[model samples]
Target: MDIFEDKVILVTGANRGIGRALVKALLNHGVRKIYATCRDLNTMPSLDDDRITVLSLDITNDEQITTVAVLAQDTEILINNAGVINAGNILEGDLEGMDNDMSVNYFGTIKMMRAFAPILKKNNPSKIINIVSIAAYSPLPSIAGYAASKAALFSATQSVRIELAKEGIAVYAINPGAIDTDMNKGSDWDMPDPESTAVKILEYVADGKFDIVPDEMGQGMYNAWREDPAKLSKIFSDLYYGEISE
Candidate 1:
């Protein structure tokens, strides 16, 4: 499906990073409208375009999701891009950190699907995009809880894809590698700019590329995964510069 024209899209975590970049990308494509949502409306960066409507939405909150669903009833595309990373590991990760990661990354996104999938189905031929990560394929030992949450989200994405297919709603999962965003601040590895990354993702999606892993690292890991899933563990382990002790 071509997403570049005459579509109403809703993006979560639109205040900054990839989500923010996507808003601009969609605008450039001449999409009809965009419901750009963030936790705090005031914190949302102003997009000069009148087609963009900034809304306050914290996906973890069911009431807010329901409210936004009603408000954006005409939405044809939903971009689940909100995410969080907690600094912890399975061996000694903080309980709160794990819970926060799970609540935001896994449950939050799934809940968003639950709330919007019906609305999208009503629109017919609508689409859903989940911004996942390469970490979902293999655990990153340092951010164990975050990786685990993304892994769960990856599974959920597949299941949702199957279930939503019959309803004419396309479900696409974006497994981005290390994106240069505030989320990855101080990372030792060089990361791709989120703006250019968004451009690549949108262009590929327009051509019907379902599972988009835009960056070099993401594509490399995906190629390795196609050959052998076991290689993924080693690929990430080496990137971390530490052997997986667990």
Candidate 2:
């Protein structure tokens, strides 16, 4: 079945980056309506389509989430793609930076889930898709707080999946390696295109896959978990530190 055909969908952070791409892809898949929520709806690139409804939303704001949840009551798919990355190591960074990262990435996601879980439960066969990162599995020093937030989100995704399974709602966690987005504008590593990543994610979602690793790096990390966890962890540590250790 083409899950997106005639489906009503909601994608947070739909102004730019992966979220924007996902909104376009969902439209291409025959989605009947899409609520594209961002901090400022006017900033969203012009879609010039009647099916796309631009909404102003700040995921961290409970009132905004509640308002939108009621407005998008027919939504069958919720894409939690809004996130923030604070660049700093755990030791050197101020507590505020760490808290900001957690507030937006982890708590914000949880808040959205809490607000929409009931709506989703009422609309049976709905699904919730969370955009996590490979950093969740392998933390890096430079983005320790960002990684920690995502790690917490990954754990929450697992718990949500288990708890919601009985309610007939499927929860998915999509962990992607570096993707070419404003979030990593100055990074010096190869990153996949946001559009490509979005397309791949939608494909997996259509197949009802619960967990999606959207790139080679993501698959490698998952494979290493089974083959050699310690070695993989050291490899990631060395990559971030520039030297191998005993």
Per lDDT, the best of the predicted structures is 1
- Candidate 2 lDDT for residue 129: 97
Q: What C-alpha lDDT, on a 0 to 100 scale, does residue 19 get in candidate 2? A: 98
Per residue, candidate 1 scores C-alpha lDDT tens digits across 1-246 of 245588999999999999999998888887999999999888888689989888999999999999999999999999999999998778898989999999999999999999988899999888999999988988878888999999999999999999988999988889999899998998777789999999988987888878889999888888888889889888777756653442
lDDT of each: 0.90, 0.89
lDDT of candidate 2 over 153-186, digit per residue (tens): 9999999999999998999999998899999898
lDDT of 1 at 145: 94
Record all residue pairs in model 1 with backbone atoms less than 3 Å apart, i.e. clashing: none
As a TM-score, model 1 comes out at 0.95
In angstroms, the error of model 2 at 170 is 0.3
Off by over 4 Å in 2: 243-246
**Backbone clashes (count) for model 1:** 0
Error (Å) of candidate 1 at residue 92 is 0.3
Model 1 weakest lDDT span, ten residues long: 237-246
